[model samples]
Target: MNNSVFRRLLLPGVIVLAGCSGSTDPETAHLFDNVKNLNNGEYDRQIASKDAEAAAIVRQNNAASARISTLRNQSASNSAEIKALTSQISSLRAQTSSLRGKFSNQPDKLAQLNQLDGQLVQIRADVGAGTSPSVARAELNRVSAAIRALSR
Candidate 1:
């Protein structure tokens, strides 16, 4: 009976001490909450930083896409201009050849026709080598004026 009483008393005391040791204080709970809030803040900051980086990447990609589109359009326009210039040069060469036969008897007119023919060849080379449309057109206009003078 004495041993049973001692066991019962010792067991309850040990349990109470263990429970007190394990129990958290109000300040400890507050500290845990503070730590949790800090972690949440840090996580949010990291997420925001990642989102900003992603947005920047998207913006860069969009700019590159736009530039590519613009280059493609310019390339298409250049091809069309090249085709038109080539056709115009061919027609001018034909016209100059015909004028050459007509002005054969007149040395001055024939000389001018020869000069126009040279000009046309140079312009055709410029156009073939990717000269700007405006520069090629200006050269063609000058050659056409020379041809008109020879025509008279």
Candidate 2:
């Protein structure tokens, strides 16, 4: 398709070059043709090199576009996994919290209580998507300190 369009456009250019062909006086015709051929050959070489460079650029761009598409798909998968894990943590937190008051009834109550995990999960949800896991660690530290103070 591109080749046909280029050839169609090239016809007018060929016509323009031919229009400049030949001198009315016989003496200069040979000189004119020689000079024209030299110039035309040089122009053709330049156009060929330019076309090769353009093709290289197109290939690089196409490869880059494909890479961008792959990265986008990976990002989507990572995002989905993060969401699923977040939901799972949330459900786990809900379950553990439901057992909060029941800890007093258990014989080994202190060993069974996992308040820090519930607090970390709640912190992650509050900070929202894209937050680093470190944020949850900070919440764990806070919860641990609070729990320690209460024990004393």
Candidate 3:
């Protein structure tokens, strides 16, 4: 009977001691908390890096768009100038052709006609090399007046 009583008491004490003997080492005790904090910090750093990359991409896209817009505006202006120059060139050609037809049959005006032809050739070269329309028009008027004087 005494042995049975002692056995029962000792068993309860052993269980109590086992339950109280949890991990006492500081590193081991807080291992899980430390791991959780480290993971959270890594996630925050990754998010910040992604945000910076996204902002840089946005800035690059805006810069490219601005360059494209500038190019488009310049192209439009160049096209308009080209159109005006073409019209002026056409008018000058018609006037020159008319003047040539007037002097083709007159033997006495042959020298004057030749000089006018040389002038016309030079004007055409200047126009082709990007002379201003206003200057080209003035030259054309001078040639027309010279042809008229020769005819008279």
Instruction: Encode model 1's per-residue lDDT on 26-114: one tens digit a residue.
Output: 24434444455455575467567889999999999999999999999999999998888888888988998988789778998888788
Measured by TM-score, how close is model 1 to the native structure? Answer: 0.72
Of candidate 1, the 10-residue stretch with the lowest lDDT total is 21-30
> Which regions of candidate 1 fall more than 4 Å away from where they truly are?
1-38
Query: Candidates sorted by lDDT, descending order?
Result: 1, 3, 2
What's model 2's lDDT at 4? Answer: 98
Compared with the true structure, what per-residue lDDT tens digits does model 2 show for residues 1-152?
99999999999877766667654333554554556656667546756788999999999999999999999998897677567556655654565566566665664544444655556566666546566555544654566565445344
The local distance difference test score of each candidate is 0.80, 0.63, 0.69
Which candidate number would show the highest TM-score if scored against the true structure? 1
Query: Cα deviation in Å at residue 105, candidate 2?
Result: 3.5
Give the local distance difference test score of model 3.
Answer: 0.69
In model 2, the clashing pairs are: none
Q: Is candidate 1 or candidate 2 better by lDDT?
A: 1
